[model samples]
Target: MREQASYLRIADDLRRRIAGQKWASGEQLPSRAALAREFGVSGAIIRRAQEALITDGVLEGRAGSGTYVAEQRKRCRMVRFQATGQAGAGYRGPDLGVLGEGETWEGRSDVMTPAPAEIAARLGVDEGAYCVRTAYEHLVDDKPVYLTTSWEPYDVTKGSLVVLPDGGPLAGAGVVRRMAELGISVTRTQERSEPGTTNAEEANLLGVQRGTPCTRIERTFYSDDGRAVETADIIVPSVLCEIVYELPVSRS
Candidate 1:
């Protein structure tokens, strides 16, 4: 038990070190023999530490080149919304307090524009229909976490909204919540987050280099009547967020 505990501690410590930039992404971790010497343990202990990091998506061990820090990608943990009988009931509005002061809505100066042909087709709108576009950058601890743009039919939102107050309508809250009051409920949410690179504009906003690893999230929201109402393109920094999922095993 003591040996296992020590190995876990070593793995956790190494994880923090990588996250802290002591060992940058794509860089190799110390050799098992070296790490074993550093931790005053056997090579097997160091091997166990590497295994833990691999399981956690922090490091990858190549066949011969050694263990390298994995590209920073946030892992998603599964969070199942309980069937509290509220799945179909209208979603409650999240208080502005829940969004906090960390992220603010900096107003946009540009007018809303129509989406590309592909997007227009998906939204069941004509390519020429006026769409209100709102852009936002969410910051955490003064660092940008996501750069996003949301589009809605101009005929729907009345007009483009900018600079909503903290916790105010459209503040901190995702588009799904904002439209709930308008009788627009999200009957379905499709999210596909994958490894991607930052574009020139996104890199400028995120203070990162173009082509930096990022997670692109595109979500389309639908009204209760099953009509698509809004679409959002969210760009998340790979280093900061993680996705988590849990599975229930059946016992027969």
Candidate 2:
């Protein structure tokens, strides 16, 4: 059998040390040169080993500071909407926290003069169609936890009282109630979730490292008559939040 690479072997040794509590959480690790000398390896090999640990979330690097063991992340559980749950059945605008405490949400809305093609497709409208877009940041104690962008076709909302999702009389009212005011009953929702890596923009928005694991959810709401009314894309940092889906089962 081919032997494992030197850097990988060193990384495995470090992992065992960490698991054995030789280094406590949030404790700083030895410098690369120091570790290299102790391990009888080149500095480059030590650096690679450390990088592996960083990617595993066992270590974190701070600018101008040495590497340190990462602290256990505080995880928030987010409960998804159930078809039978009254609290989450409709478009309540930006209700972020389902079971987490000390969480707050802020939203900003704008009218997209020309909506993007993908968003237009989700809303069942033509490209360049006017749409109302809202961006939201969910935070825990002022730290970003997740981000989302919601789009609604302007054709369904123009000249209506619910033009702005977070404005006018229906401000903060979820999509279902606002649409009901316009005689549109939202009866169904569809959601798709996938894993992804954070890009620079998302990393900055969520205050996480670039390339961190994340969850992306695409959601759409449909009216009773099968008209798509609204769509949203939500990005969540994996380390900070856990997405939980509570599915309902029917018995015959």
Residue-level error in angstroms, candidate 1, position 93 = 10
lDDT of 1 at 98: 18
> Which consecutive 10 residues in model 2 have the weakest lDDT in total?
84-93
lDDT of 1 by residue, 1-252 (tens): 989998999998998898789999889888899999999998998899898777556787688789998765333221223221133343332211112234343434234576777668757799978776767665555655567676666666663352231234465454556566566666775555678988878866765556768778676667778777777677765655443333356698
Q: Please name the candidate that would achieve the greatest lDDT relative to the true structure.
A: 2
Error of 2 at 40 (Å): 22
Which pairs clash inside model 2? Answer: 91-174, 91-175, 92-174
Specify the highest-TM-score model's number.
Answer: 2
Q: Tell me each candidate's RMSD, in Å, in order.
A: 13.0, 5.2
Clashes of each: 11, 3
